[model samples]
Target: MAQITLRYIPFKTDVAFLQIKQTEVSGIPLYIIFFYIHVYSAIFVLLAGFTQFNSYLLKKRPTIHRNIGRLYVFTILFFSAPSGLFIGVFANGGFYSQISFVTLSILWFYFTLKGFTSIKNQNITQHKAFMMRSFALTFSAITLRLWKIILVNLFHPAPMDVYQIIAWLGWLPNLIIIEYYLYKQSKK
Candidate 1:
């Protein structure tokens, strides 16, 4: 996430600094702004989410946990998810990629909202379940990059083709695995 931030910080001045060439050509200033917000807030989401799951911190200093949780939710709801939805329509790899991103953005927002409301209702188990779902979606940022590297570098698939696959692969597996884990935990 830090690497992405460092790479993108210069993009404010130089559109050439953009990693995705397609983004440069599409170059609507509004889209650029939203994309920047999405990327930046995503980093915060990742950072805030890291501490959120720390059992020791959560148990010992729940106030801190709640604070960070609030940050995470706010970042996603106000910045990340909305920007993501805006940028998603212009995502590369055509309609498939666009659909994947749009759906992911919506689901990310939905799960995070559900988690927040569950906690507000004092339903800890439901809150945790929804949060797990939300974070699984959040982790797609990492997974997407990883899949890109592997698919592009190793197999040398066409970038658009690999992107189409990774768009869904990125979050689907994460969500599936988390659901499985949640199911198992519930059984126990």
Candidate 2:
């Protein structure tokens, strides 16, 4: 009986270890790799953009602001936006994911352009304000990922189903938040 018990113990231990390994390998590596890049880059841009905005607001340093803003816009407009759009299109979900990304692209363009035009017209205040909204939207990339996580855990464990809603979930909430804040600022 003791010999039989010891033999089964090793078998059980091996099976348990194999189960743990399989569970760890359950996630798709390719998706995770791209996601890591997408997430980290988006966060970097958001943090850096906010720092530049704060500097402009407090010091009113046009030179530093303009330079930083230019860098920010270039990064978002060219690199971040394009990459996001691509990932959005290839997103594990379907129509929802596509629409969400398309919306992000448009808003990013519109707000950024408005900010640029405002600056051209020598309307620094308006430019700054509009740019704030644009950058907020840009930062939505991060929010979208977060929403995807919550939705996956709560409503849809499948990436595809969650992907569908997250397309809208990502930016729409951010926009709503922007609107709400703008409204509050107006009241003040």
Candidate 3:
């Protein structure tokens, strides 16, 4: 994640490095602005959210946990998700990839909101379940890159083909895995 963040820092000045479809978005001022918002906020959300599942942090520093949770929720709702939706429309792999990304963005927002409201309603279990779902989407940023690397090296598919697969593969599997984990945990 830190490496990704560093890679993106250069994009602040040189959006040419964003590459292909993303670079195409650079011409549209609004899209470019939203792209930066999406990237930076997503990074922050990912980092802050990583600590959220730590039992030790929750047990020993509840205030820190709550604060980070608030930051994660706020960042995703206000900045990351909306910008992601915008950028997803211009995603690389035509309609299929666009749909995948847009769907992920919508689910990410919905799950986060549900999690927030669940906790507000004092439904801790529901809150945890919804948040697990939300973070699974958040972790898509990482999984996308990992899948891209694997697919590119292993199959050497065309850029669009790889993008198409990773677009759906990224978040969908994460959500499925998290749901399975949550179900098993509930049984316990």
Candidate 4:
């Protein structure tokens, strides 16, 4: 993920994914700004998320876990989610894709915030459930791209069709898996 994100460094608006978003970059006055904000802040969120699920960190270095968890939650709430929500409005693939992205941003914010508040309230079970859901959503950042590659390789669908599909595919399966896991945990 870091490797993928590095492309945006020494930023240029005409590179990689932005190459396709030129129309948005040109027309949606704040699109470029929010795009960069989402791009930059998302790395931190992903990195913070990577550290948060380590059992060793949680057991032996809880302070580190807590700090990183806070970083993940706060960054999502303040930076990534808002920027995502903004950019999602002008998301590629038109209205349905826009709805999917916007819904994703809103749900991401809700789950992350719920996890944070649950932890603060010392509701460990609730926190774990919500954080699992939150992390699944975070994982969408990777899954989205991976799905795009696989779909393009195997099926060669139109770019916008792929975009529209991935807008939901990116996160839906992750959320479902997490929900299923949570249900099993509850059963136990």
Order the numbered candidates by lDDT, best leading: 4, 3, 1, 2
Candidate 3 clashes between residue pairs 3 or more apart in a chain or in different chains: none
What C-alpha root-mean-square deviation, in Å, does candidate 3 show against the real structure? Answer: 1.7
RMSD of 4: 0.9
Model 3 TM-score is 0.93
Predicted structure with the largest TM-score when compared to the true one: 4
The C-alpha lDDT values of all candidates are 0.89, 0.65, 0.90, 0.92
- After superposition, the stretches of candidate 4 with alpha carbons farther than 4 Å from their true spots are none
For 25-103, candidate 4 gives per-residue lDDT tens digits of 8988888889999999988988889888899999999999998898899899999999999999988999999999999
lDDT per residue for candidate 3 within 37-143, as digits (tens), equals 99789889998889999999889998999999999999999999999999899888899999999999999999999999999999999999999999999999999
Single out the weakest 10-residue window by summed lDDT for candidate 1. 16-25
**Residue range with the least summed lDDT across 10 consecutive positions in model 3:** 13-22
True-vs-predicted CA distance for residue 9, candidate 1, Å: 1.4
* True-vs-predicted CA distance for residue 149, candidate 3, Å: 0.6
TM-score of each: 0.93, 0.68, 0.93, 0.97
For 98-127, candidate 2 gives per-residue lDDT tens digits of 777866877787787788789889997788
